[model samples]
Target: MDRNSLIMSLPFRTSSPPLNWSSADCCNWEGIACDPRVAYNNLTNITGAIKILMRCKFLSVVLIGENFFHETIPSDDSIAHSNGFRNVQHLSIIGCHLTGQIPMWLSNLKKLKILRLNHNRITGSIPGWFSTLPRLKHLALTHNHFSGEFPKELCALPALISAQALENDTNTSILPLFSIFGRTIYQYNSVSSLWPGISLRNNSLGGKIPIEIGRLKLIRELDLSNNNFSGNIPSQMSELTNMERLDLSANRLSGEIPISLANLNFLAKFSVANNNLSGPIPSGTQLQTFSPLAYDGNAGLCGSPLPKECTHTVKSNKDKKTQDEKVGGHRIPWFQITVVLGFITGFWGVCSSLVLNCNWRNAYFQFLENLGDQLYVTMAVSWARLLRRLL
Candidate 1:
């Protein structure tokens, strides 16, 4: 393409703005480098529509970071109808302060592999069509204000759970290099090994974390922290055996921490702090290796890592129930014993008095004898009178 063609398609102004479109070679411009296969623009103060970017058929990677643009994600029909940009494999446009929801047109890039749109003002729910992308491996949407329910469709993606591809496979390809924090990344491949799993952190999004999250068995990082999400942490998340970093902090999550999470042997960085989580932290896991702050803000959480202790030293539900039974068994039945002792004392005292006192015993027998004699005399008198009358 001629310099004029490239200039017309350029949407943003770079540090070294092209002074004259008459320039024969784009390589001659400052802050711009071009290999036969790649074009790199070291840009800032960039403005205008980004739709023109989709016109490049050979463009496999579009990594634009910290560059100012017209704030359009290029979702309008004009760009969607364009025939070029069919080979985009890795697209990362981060920290550009771009506004508007993630565009629907991005779905047209059938070959898209890794997508990072974090640190932007993008709004709306994560699109369900994202699951349709067959090659999508990594997605990061942190620090956006996306407000809606967690996209259930995303958890069913098979590519995210597939075995990781070797980084060396992309060595022959031209990868974009960018700076993050204060350090410069040498190559995209070297840093992408930790391409965080579904980083939708720091948003207004609310709702229960779906149980389908556990289906990502091979995922490395899953961060959904700093949102209004409510409900118990899905026990199914324990199925992510390969997970390295898991952060669900600063949410409205409740209930006990899943013991299964403790089985994640590969876990390195983990946190569930500032949530409604309760019960003892699972024992015998790397979760306890984290500082107490990891479990802080959860009033119900207790254990070694946390300062508060459980009411009972229970290892499991069964152990707790057994302890309760033992406690109940040791209780004395004082009321029943008291009643039985009282009854026995009253009966024995009365009988012993009668036996020991001769006068009392004689009176009791004499009263029964006299009553029997009186009854016999009355019966005799009645019989005599009746016999006389008959004669």
Candidate 2:
């Protein structure tokens, strides 16, 4: 078989300068390299790629992106135990049509520095062992079907720089001491070379955001939007001094937003809309910089960003209720009161004229006297006429 036919048989394309199979050294081919060297193969079938990795050794990087490998990753222990990608440092299977939970064999690649399985249909709870990888730096599982609470172990990955699980089925309560389990896992300063970011948006996640997240002072972005999270925005979050973006919108959270959040000098994107939050919005340049939409849908929330004004201070329920009733009572129509007063005044005026004015009293009595006399005279005439007729 010719080299072109063999290359064509594989279910992927190669970029130019095309693979020069005619050359005696296959390593010189496009997307293939050797030196004491690195191999950069991309956009290939998963099963075939695995078959090659199984036989070959000394690979340092394997990138397989945007492929149609629609099969479950082999979970067989024997296959996992095989000598494939043992020396690999970076592995990416992003945008592949891979399904099922992460293969158990992945735990064997102890040298892996980056693992990206994002933008696939992979389901099931994320394995906790992923955090045990000592050299891992970037872990992305975004836009998948992963379920259950976020693994708290992820917070313990000392070398982890960036982790994302956005648009998944992840759910969990973030405890107060969630990542504060003894010694600090992150040793680097806020300006460390690694830009750590955590995204867990658009999921079924619930419970309060852990105050312990402030411990990740080096983290740049933290997103927990569109979930079932409740309670107040943690005041400890102000400790994320290096934070750039923070989103906690569309949740069941209540209580006034913490005034301490004004300390987030680096905060560029902040939102907590569509929540049960109330009270005067915390005042600061950072808080005031956001639009009204950022604080909308929260009827109890008031202040500058919104049109609703805050009046007298109210604490207890009784005071609030009484104030509300007083305001409502003041809204009654003056026209209604005027109509009632006019009716009472007209009635009293006419009655008082008859009682107090002698002319009006005499005139009223004279009419009554005339009416009684006419009735008596008519009765007498009728009796006389009846007697004459009988005679």
Pairs that clash in candidate 1: none
| CA-only RMSD, every prediction | 12.7, 18.1
* lDDT minimum window of 10 residues, candidate 2: 172-181
Residue range 212-295, candidate 1, lDDT tens digits? 888877678888999999999999988988888889999999999998887788987898999999899988778889999888
Q: How close is candidate 1 to the true structure, as a TM-score?
A: 0.68
**Best of the candidates, lDDT:** 1
lDDT of 1 at 240: 89
lDDT of residue 336 for candidate 1? 91
Scored by CA lDDT, what does every candidate get?
0.73, 0.66
Give TM per candidate. 0.68, 0.56
In candidate 1 the C-alpha lDDT for residue 277 amounts to: 90
